[model samples]
Target: MIDYQLDADGLATLTWNVADRPMNVLNQASIAAFTKAVERAISDPSVKGVIVTSSRPEFVAGGDLDLIRNIRDVAQSMDCSGPVSRILRRLETSKKPFVAAVNGSALGGGLEICLACHYRIVADDPNIQLGLPEVTIGLLPAAGGTQRLPRMIGIKKALPYLLEGRKADPAKAFEAGIVDAVVPSSELLSRARAWLLSAPAEAAIKPWDRKDFRFPGGSPQSPGPIQIFFGASGALLAKTQGNYPAQEAILACVYDGCQVDIDSGLKIEQRQFARLAISQSTKNMIRVLFYDMNDANRLAGRPKDVPKRSFKKVAILGAGMMGAGLAHVASTAGLEVVLLDVSGDAAEKGKAYGAAILEGQVARGRIDESVRDATLGRVIPTTNYSDLADCDLVIEAVFEDRAIKAEVTRKAEAAMRVDAIFASNTSTLPIGGLATVSKRPARFVGMHFFSPAEKMPLVEIIRGAGTSEETIAEALDFARRIRKTPIVVNDCPSFYANRAFAMYPYEAMTMLAEGVNPNLIENAGRKAGMPMPPLALIDEVSVELLYKAMKQARADQGSSYCAQPQDAVLIAMVEQFGRLGRKAGRGFYDYPSDGERKLWTGLTEHFPRAEKQPSVEEVHERLMYSQSLEAARCVGEGIVSVRDADIGSLLGWGFPSFLGGVLGQIDTVGLPQMITVCDRLAQHMPERYAVPQILRDMAASGRTFH
Candidate 1:
């Protein structure tokens, strides 16, 4: 309902409160209500000023995303422009000052609504963000925003915001001309009233409509903007690699809107926005990055229902790369950390890792010198177990040996408080076995931080059979506190990601044995959207680790490890030839500090390049699909943590983020088709490429991986 109240000062306050919703959103009902309220304020001579506010936590969130998602017909979507722009035009034309008081977030159409008003005053709530982020979701501002925002802020500044689709902080919003002022929550209404009272109680057409308004970089009569439109179109295609459609749609809307009158411009916007909203890229982006991602992070599978996780000090038990990175992140998050190792020098080396990273961040302007110093100061290094006595959590990121891990677990358990959590960073060892070494097994769990923990986001929290609910919740909370995405997984081989991911390198190494050029196989991996090809990935992992993983696979899989043609080749290289890997400057590739990484040319005589060029498609499938099929089997066999399996793949390994997750990629490409491709290729791929039962079931039921 369009309810309006006018005070004796001739100031009319129109409040929007959508029933059964926490935030105000623009939809047909709200738009209709807005039109009615605006008409009332315009017709009443008693109303000298109009105040638009929300009676909810958020001033205005945006348009209903579900409504946008259903807009498949571009022409029908275009029709929405007529009434929307008409109301905005009418409100602008009303001979009364219109001011918006944003009590919370003002985003998308919400921000567009504020742009239609004369001025905006926003609450300074830290939770509040203000911007037009339509581009990121595969759409653009359609309700006269493309036309108005640029007119207010100038083209260059507005273009970056529209293209990138980032929500700005309140202060940033004010500075960027998206909002005029920011006020604290308690004084939001009074500050808004003061501004409204001081503003001239009259309205005029916007500065853009003035006869003398000249768009910067272009005269209204010139071809300058035309050059920009064509230039920007090319740049968008180049940067996005034609992988996204939002940038093109945004550019098209703005270019057309700028040259036309406001009435006709709205039509162009609605049409482009609709087409973009339904494009494959946009649909996939919203499903993966927004909906499913939110679902993954919010899941609570454990019994804890723990209210809070308290940990003021953290102790890391190993001074290796993973342990040092854990110390860095913990200290940076305002937790006092003690880095301990077997000896004093080892502990000192771990502290150096934190110092090196922080110093570089300071140099790059990512963190100030004081912040860097503060972070480094929080991480105290020592070899003494006494230093870990008061620590609330002790994480051991050591080798994968079961014996070593069990020993470390006992030591960590003994050093910390009885209630403190002891986490093992062992990727492949049985967490249950390690927990058995602890007296308080309920307080022990697995906090598997991927190598280079500071950079990687996902932390796989493995719940040991005896781990307490409180321990799991506290570990998950600790991961979040350090700005990481954490997923809870039942302990099993590889947990989820690395276990399935190790298959790719094995497949690539197998291909190398079949006379495929090592570089060609690696190049195919990269073209398939992997950050590194298998050989390069193996080098980064070190040759000794790959050999150990292969050995483990052989022992576990038995018949599943039935030798493919290339398995014999890697086995011979690692066992018979004594050519370990990058350490020896040889393996599948050669490396020296100063030279370009190239395949060992001499090995070409030993393993010749294949006479036939396998299509990049064929090569990518053999390498990537083998791992995906194994991942499906792992999921079916309860080796993976369900619900978040795909996100785990991306963060644990470099599974492509654009594909959403591994299963999401399968769904996007059609799981049935993927299964068919894998099955057909299995003839030559041995056990690695064989389609798993899960894929077969999904194919039969026509179900997606999600």
Candidate 2:
């Protein structure tokens, strides 16, 4: 709802207050009324100046992300674009000065409306973040944002923000020449009024008004833009491996739009918008990854009546890679982390790791020197459990062995408040076993942080058989506190990402067993544009650790983790010869501590008969398929919510981002086609190649992923 009031001074204030939402959303009804209001504001001569402000707690949030996301038809896309363009064009062509008073966030279409105004005045507060981040929803800014933004702000300046989709603060937006000025929240409306009344009432300059205004130095034809575009395109391709269609369309939109007239550019953007709208990845992404993840996180796996717990201090046990990285993230994100180890030196070493990362941030000017120091200071290093006596949560990262983990749990719980949650950072082991050692097992839950915790976004919050609902909520909260997305998975070995991901490298090696060369699988991973080749990843993760996991698997899964028949190269290196892994300086590839590690020539000594040759596609499929099929099984068995699992893969493992995520990859792979391919491989390797029922049915029904 809106109220238009005209004062005797000839200034009109149009206040927005949506019926009940905390923030305003541009829905069909709102857009329709908004367009009418725009027409009226432009027509009335009594209205000498106009200021758009919100009566709600915050300003307009954006177009409802779900609305445009669900409109799968071309005509619907056109219909949606019409009202947006109409309101913006009316504001642009208005005779009187038009201004926006942004009291809070002005995002997506909300920011677009501000851009359309002759003047935009934002409140100078940490809360006011403005940006045109339409790319997140698999769509570009269709309401003349592509045309007007480059003209309002120089193309070079606008391109970075638009192309990468970043949010800018009010001061930065002012410097970039996007917003007209910034003011305090108390005076935002008053400031907007003064600007509208006295500021150069020069009718808003539209991009279409000028011709020959060359785009910021990087015109597609110019060396600057050409190099940037092509270079960026190549990088995008490498990062996505041609898996995501959205980036391709986004690139095309910016390239074609900037080169042509404003009208032509809009058409290009609109066409791309429609095409992307109907895509399976787009819909699935909007539903599962974006919408679903957001909703689930807000729900936080707790009863609506439960009072939320906020833990400001967390004590993490052990100072290994996971423990150190966890301390870094926890400290940096405004939490006090008590890092404990067996000795003071071990605790300091973990603290040093956090210090190094902070130093890097300082070097990049990402944080001030003092802030970096203060962040490091927040991480208190100690060798005693008593240091965590008052801490709100204590997470153990000591060992995977039941006895060691149970001992750590008892010690951690002793240091906690009566209700302080205790969590274990175990990857494959069951949480129920770990919970048994806790004085209050209901307060103990599994908080499985992926390796290199600072870099990975996923933290599987496992709810064990005896874990309380409150414990699940607390772990989820703890994961968020450390800036990781938490997926509340029911306790199981390997949880989600690793459990589904373990077979990929093994299958790639299996392809090598069938006479495929080790180098062939490695090159296929590279040529396919994977972030890391299978062998290289294995080495970096330390082949020795994988060998340990395999030994553990032998006991749990009933047999040793074996490679494919032709995988004699690794089979001999890890199995027959007992050379162990990276720790042993042996394995499929040899690693010498003093210098760079290289592929061992000893590989030939292991596989005597198999030839070293295979196509790139074959090698890529072996690794990608195994992962994809298992991801499908996880979906079929409902181990994780479909959207959360896909997001987990994209955020957890380096599942080629261009595919959007794993489920997205399945759609792109064409379920039926992939199933047929799997069938062929199944004949030779049944255990590794069998297609999951989801994929088979998707293919059989001619259904696409959405």
Candidate 3:
């Protein structure tokens, strides 16, 4: 894993090249090898100095997160980081000068290793990123990162990278004082060698090791530290609402670690790292964000017998916002797209939307003009059905009406080739019903793209009863091609995401009608870590549209539909008050052409205020418990698996990441406690808050969702 070589110039090179792995990660075996290499370089008669570099395109990713995840307890977690910390400490204190030649991404423990060297010279590659991003995975950097970074860049300046997990390219890293020099990729080694040969022996001792050295931003009692630490504490509480322990732990590491000597500081960071590594929050985040997300991306559990497929051409049958956005994203991903509509003019209008978005990208310097032109040129717009002749797939993003969808399916299928698949982007309609018009029922699937398809990261793939495994695999592959995360679900009205998501707004509206202050309701949603307050989200999705969905559900589900109680709130806002939504500049809140919006003060007139109201905690519980209960019901009914339910709740509806996802929330707040809360709420709203039998059994058994 560590190759040690001494040249005629007395400069030793330690190249990291872990066998059988694409990228080198600092694990127990590699750290032990590195320690031996360091001792050899220090004692060898022929070696005068050392140069640390990589044998691959990138240096290292970070410490082995898999190892961190497998830790049985705090002692094991400490053991995981303790070795690397000691190795880095010995290298930094060695009398012989050491320089790092960073080739590519040096994140987390990777950058921590570089910080221990006397000097760092990076290749001038735009793709090379450098930073300590341990906090993103819910741990502070344990290998002297907290102590070394602030000593080099000052505490105030280093806070952003530590807090936000920000990384920078070579130029930015140099500007941020993370690296000593930037050179051409070809000259990186030569530059490191030259620095080692020319620099005095005293350069081996870091500034932090000097007895007379003062901290860059002054001591912890200085004005900058006082303001940044206190101000950031308040901001963090407001942003996270104390839901994430990692953020606060990071703050604690920096504040306390910077107050002592370098070695003591590293010890402080190590203990904190162990504490957070074993935390349930960190464990939940790793399982969902890393393990589950990676599994979904690879299409795990897909039929192994099915052959791999690639999508080359696609046809979108509509010219509205959803269709146009799909065309833009498809073309951007190097696929030929045929955008169709009722007429040539309408189709051209849809094409123009993509052009406008690319032009905006050009204005922001994200892409050059030539690239924009090339991307837009791949989209062919026309009204004729013949344009879809050679297409591999056709997605019908027409209006959400069963009759309209069935009509489009029949028309588009006639133009599609024999092997082509048909997909529907219906938000609420079932895929099995829409597939009735397809001649090859097994080839039909649902690829439900969220609104503004070009930007949303998630695409919910729904499989009807008759859909073939081949078709499902192809749909998932296509979703990957478009750079969208997918979670497979079985066909149902609203499928998984939308079915559970509707409960969020319904509960919010119920609160509104019961005379809870609109402002309080909105604040509670934000404090609960929802991306948007339920009312604000309703306005963006359109109050009129939600009312129509509710009406449709009532007609289809009969008088016993659970959302009926929330209908009065939607009716008064859309019909009686003439407040359609944000598009109409009025709803539960007023959206003006200019300036900020506030709650429409007239809401109390239609729905009178009550003599007493529920606490903010009660309102928050209603919002979260309602959606989570529905998610569990979806899981119990087999509409979605346990992992997919959590994935959908997170990417589809913006469920808070700190809670992991809907199912994760059950684990965060113990299952039995969630059951108790659900029982209390069910006393008044049993239809929405009643716990599923599966949840009750799990609570009784003391089992978690994981």
Candidate 4:
């Protein structure tokens, strides 16, 4: 809600506070109310100046995304966007000075509102961030942000914030010409009023309003503008691989807007925002990045019947890299951690790993030595099983063998309390198979943390057949406590992430054997927006482990298993060439101690490159589509929800966020079109590329997975 109050000094303050909402967002109702408030202050002869501030902690977060997503067409988008721009224009042209009192973060349209004011004075809070970050969620700043930001800061300086949607601290905001001054939080309102009254009437006018105004970075015809616009095309392609329409739209908006006047520039921005709004890419991004991500982090499917459980102490078995990282995260969250290993020395070494991490933080000034010591002190390292007696939960981070996991399951359960839950940090093994060895199968679950657990954000919570809702709720709670995003999944070998992720390297190997150039394969992977090239990723995950996982999967599933044609490639590399992986300093790519690694030239001897090589587009589809189709199968099998599928793909294995995860890719390409592509791919590799029945059904019904 917007409230207007006039001070005795002829200064009016408009306060923002949305009812029943923690943050103020510019929705239709709010925008209408805001326009009315702005009109009141501007029209009143008694009110000489206006100071805009928030009653809440933050000034305004941004436009309500629900409203943005509701935009069905250009008409609807313009209907939503037009009034705000008109109101801001009226405010700036009223000849009544306006000062923005940014008490906290002013992001997206929030900052755009500030840009319409005569001056912006931010509270010197360390937590405040100011920027136009709409591009992050597949939209540009439609409320004159694209036009105003570039005009204020110049195109070259503003491109990073607009293109990448980077947030800036209060100090950086002042430096970036986003704010005129940064004052203490207590003085924010007072300073705003003072500036509003003292600032010259001519200064209140926007740069575009002045007859002498010139484009800060020159028009599109200027050399700098020419180079920036043309140069940005190749740079953005290299970064995004042309997978995201939003990035290209951003560049287009900035370039096109800069060529015209302020009114025309605002029109260009609004038109571009409309185009991006209706884009399938934008819809997919909003679905996964905003809605699905929020649901996963909030534990949407958490059983309402089960009461929340707070984990006070946790025991970790096998104090290796995974276990050590677990100890660090747990202790960092102020939970008591018992790190156990086969020997006291090994456990101590794990504790030492935590100490080292804490020391690094202290050295970096992230924490003091006292806090480091306190966090390190929380981790109790010992070989004795009795040390885990008081622990509320236990996580087994041992080897990925079923026998070894079962052995630790028995030992950990013997020491754990009867009601305490048990979890495995296995990347590939099925939770149901491991739960069979547990005394309390109902409390057994899988908390699959990726490698370097302290860093990776996702934790795939696998539910066994007998695992209770209480166990899932408790696991999710614990994951949230450690600041990790948890995605609940059904019991399946490799579960969600690894199951789909394996397709990348598999396709790369298949291509290699088919005489595609190794360089081309890796280049396509990078161009397709994977975090690392397929060959490099294989090296990091290790080829020997891949082979072992394949063998285990084949043996366990028997006739139901899908045998990949590229299995022989992995076998030959690990067994015949004696190249285990990065660990062995050799694999698909040779890893040397001195410099950057390159594709093994010897690959040509084993599988010679074809004279007629596949194009990057063909290779990119093979690698990405293989994973996406497998993800569709996972959804069909009910191993994961559509939301979880998207979240897991992005956070779990570094799927391109711009593509909005795997399901997003399907939506972007269209369900029927994706099916057609999969059908074509199946012609080449039926075992890997076969379309799931669910996808076929959806295509027939004209329905999307999301």
Candidate 5:
């Protein structure tokens, strides 16, 4: 995989281009080839220095995750990480200057390799990111990243990149001393060669390898670093809530490694990496966040018979928050967007929302003023239905009411091309029911974008009974174009993500009605790795919205409706106390203009605390199992596939990635163990804790979701 060539000046150039793969990744086969190339260059008498670069778009994507995913023991973990570490160490300490000519993004093992070289010079491209981001996928940078990065920069500077898995573009990387220089793509190779040729023999030695080298920041024993370590530990625990072991492991690697010699520090890093490699958390993350997520993004569930389609123009009906956000994303993706509402003024206000966001991006230096102006210029705000006539797709982000949605659907369809697709951005209403109003039911579909569509990554593409394969293909294509992960589901109430996620907040309210302490309930949710505590999430989403949805469901189902225990709590909060939500600045928590929100003291007056409280573990399990059980029911009912269920849970509702997704949590907890927990929970609330038959069958058959 390594193409080795010697120049007239005795400079050896090793160009990495793995023939089979699009990007050069560090794997057994490629590592072995690279080792041979390094050995040949070092042993050859004619070679004076070496330059490493890649012919692919990316220098190296990272380690082969397939190999890391299969690592089952410490020995396998060491074997997976050790060889590359050894090879890189040899390259850096061989007394031969090596320069890394980074042409594109270099992350994890890719950045680790760059750190090993005597000097790193990257192409001056904003898209080129360089960082050690292994912690994000549940492992530390095993191949000498933890050791070398801290030495190259400092402990304080390196900790954020290593712990949080932050990436820096070419300019930021140069400012942070992660790379020596940044040059144009065309001059990358020549610049690397020039640095190698002009460097003295002493330049071959790394700072840490020299006996007199001192760390840029103080050592671990110094007051500043010790204080940083203290603060970082507390911050890590607070941020992670102790759900992720990888962060703790990374903190230990840097703190423990940097105090000793480079070789000893590397061994410390490898040992920690081996422990995390075979961790259950690591496996779950790699499976759901990596593998399953990749499957969803690639449109794995799309009908194979239909060819891929593209959208040139899309019209969004209603210029509220959701509609405006849709316009922003579509226009940003280079599609002409018609953002329409009832009046011209309303539509113009919606367009201003996108403009404000673009202005912020320009101020942050994230985008140039030219790019901002061009992107905003593509969104045409108007009240005319005739504007959608030439559009390939029209998505209505109107009111959740069926009559209002049906009205917009009929109007948009009347003004659009015959073959163009019509989509409703409804999260709860059944897509098939909504399609009944359309003259062309085959073209009617649901494209459910979460609130603040520009930020949320998920788009649940609901396939109605009469929806054509071509319509589904086009919907998936539009989701991809806007950079959202689309999960296709058969039509049903609340759909997959909302149906499964609703249980989370409902269970918390159930406990509140049972006299469980509100603080305890919120803490348990956060401790379980939920992005927001149940009460806080409810407040943010607005309790008024929840009450309305509950009332609507009751009206629709009539006598067949099954009222949850939380219904009483919702009624008392909204009707009895008139505490609408955060929007009203009065809900479960009392928001102040001058201070951070605190739990309303009147909560206990209404829902008094019980004399005895449940353990935190019990509360945590109740919250986790409630959501996973509903996800299992979705799978059993054939509403969603197993992979989509997991991916949707993650990207849709912020189900903890470290636990995988909801289904991944079930698999990790073991089918039998999950059933056992559910059975125990069912003793209290049978309806809420009812286990799906799919879990039992999988437990009996020894099957896993992954």
Candidate 6:
């Protein structure tokens, strides 16, 4: 995998190109080959210095997660990280200068390898990212990242990249001193060779290994670093709520390791990595977030017989936030978008949304002005249905009303190609029911994009009863085209994500109706690792909207509908009181124009706090079990698969990555224990807490979701 070449000038070049893999990863086999190549260069009298580069598009993708996933103990974790760490350390101190010519994105172990070199240079490609982002996947950088990065930059400057797993492009990386230089792709290798050829013997030795070397800013004990560490620890606790051990472990590694020599610091990093690597949470995260998520993105469940589809031009019906956001993503993906609305002005306004977002990206230096203009130019806003005549796909993102959706569906189909797919961006409405209005029901499917569609990572592809395999494939293709993770689910009310996620807010409101303190309810949700507390989440989504959805469901299902305990609170917030939501500047919490939002003082008058309140642990369990149980029901009902359920839960909503999504949470809580807890909880709310038969069967068979 490592191709070694030597020039007459005594400069060795090692190019990494792993066979059968898209990107080079640090695994046992690859690491062994790399070590052999490095050793050869170090021992050869003809070799004076070395340049490390990649033949693949990306320098390296990081460690082989498959290898890391199987690590079950501390020894195994050490075995996985130790050899690579030692090899990198040896390369830096071999008395021969080494330079990393990074051609593309280098992350985690990849960036660690770059740090080991005497000098680092990268291609000036906007897509080339450099960072140690191991904490995001529930592990720290075990191969000398935590130590070398802080030393290369400083404690203050490096903490964000290390702890938060933030990545930077070539310019930002060069500015932050993560890279020594940024050059054109053509000059990458030549520049590395030039630097290595001119370097003195002292350049081979790292600053940390020198006798008189001082830290870039100050040592770990200095007042500035101490304050930064304290603030970082507190911020990490507040953000992660102590659920993610990787962040805490990373902090400890940087704090403790920076105080010692480089060798000792590497050992400290390895130990911290081992502790996190062997933990169940880490394993769960790697399994779901990495493997399962990759599977979904690859459309693993797509019908085998159907050929893949590619969308060229897409027409979006309506110019609201969802429609505009869809237009932005479609245009960005190089598809011509026809943004249609009832009025010409309304359509223009929708197109402006994409322009505003692109402008912001340009202002932030995320994209070039030329790229922004090109993307904006792809969107054609108008009121004419004829604009959609040549579109390959047409999605109706109009209001969530049957009549309005039916009107747009009929109109768009009339002007579109006979084989072109039609979809609805519905969050709760059933695609099967909506398909009744379509002339070609087989082509009708649900492409449910979450709010601010361009940003959300997930696109729930709902398959209607009549949706053809080809249509499903097309929807999956479109979702993939926009680089969004696609999870296929059978059509039902709320499909999968909304059905399972609704339980979170409902449970919180039920607690409020039971006289539980609002603050305690909100805290329970946050401590459970949810992105937003239930009350605040509902306010953002709007209490009036929830009330309307509840009313519609009650009307549709008639006597079959089961009223939730939260229904009374929803009605009180919307009708009895004038509290609509955040839009109305009042709801469960007041949204002042000048200050942070807090719970409405009048909440106590309507729902008095109980003399004896539920424990925070109890509240946390209730909220978690409620949502997870619903997710299990979705799996049992065949609405979604176990993998999709987990992936959807994590990406669709902000289900904590550390918990490994909803079903993974159940597996984490052993099935037997989960069922027992559900039985206990069933006494309070039997209908809501009822355990699905799938969990009981899995428990009986001693099976886990993974």
RMSD of 1: 4.3
Clashing pairs in 3: none
State the C-alpha lDDT per candidate.
0.77, 0.75, 0.88, 0.89, 0.92, 0.92
Query: Candidate 5: where is the Cα deviation over 4 Å?
Result: none
Better of 4 and 5 by TM-score: 5
Clashes of each: 0, 7, 0, 0, 0, 0
Please list the residue runs of candidate 4 whose C-alpha ends up more than 4 Å from where it truly belongs after superposition. 20-22, 211-232, 359-365, 368-370, 554-562, 592-595, 610-612
Q: List the residue pairs that clash in candidate 4.
A: none
Scored by lDDT, model 5 comes in at: 0.92
Candidate 3, residue 591: how far the Cα is off, in Å: 2.6
Point out where model 3 deviates above 4 Å.
Answer: 20-22, 212-220, 557-563
Q: How do these models rank on TM-score, best leading?
A: 5, 6, 3, 4, 2, 1
Per-residue alpha-carbon lDDT of candidate 1 for residues 352-459, written as tens digits (9 for 90 to 100): 999999889888977899898888889999888888889988998877776787777777666778878889988877688777778988988898888788898888
What are the clashing pairs of model 2? 240-658, 243-658, 244-658, 513-566, 513-567, 514-566, 544-582
Residues 285-404 of candidate 5: C-alpha lDDT, one tens digit per residue: 988878888888888878888878878999999999999999999999999999999999999999999999999999998899999999999999999999999999999999989999
lDDT string for model 2 (273-378, tens) is: 7887777667766665566567656654554555677978888899988999999999988899999999999999999998998889889978899999889989
Evaluate residue 653 in candidate 2 and report its C-alpha lDDT on the 0 to 100 scale.
73
The better-scoring model by TM-score among 1 and 2 is 2
Worst 10 residues of 3 by lDDT: 556-565
> Model 2, stretches more than 4 Å misplaced?
20-22, 199-201, 211-223, 303-307, 362-378, 413-418, 435-440, 517-531, 555-620, 635-638, 656-660, 667-674, 692-706
Q: What would the per-residue lDDT of candidate 6 be over residues 121-165, giving only the tens digit for each residue?
A: 999999999988888889999999999999989999999998889
Candidate 1 lDDT score at position 321: 90
Worst 10 residues of 1 by lDDT: 200-209
For each candidate in turn, the TM-score is 0.84, 0.87, 0.95, 0.94, 0.99, 0.98
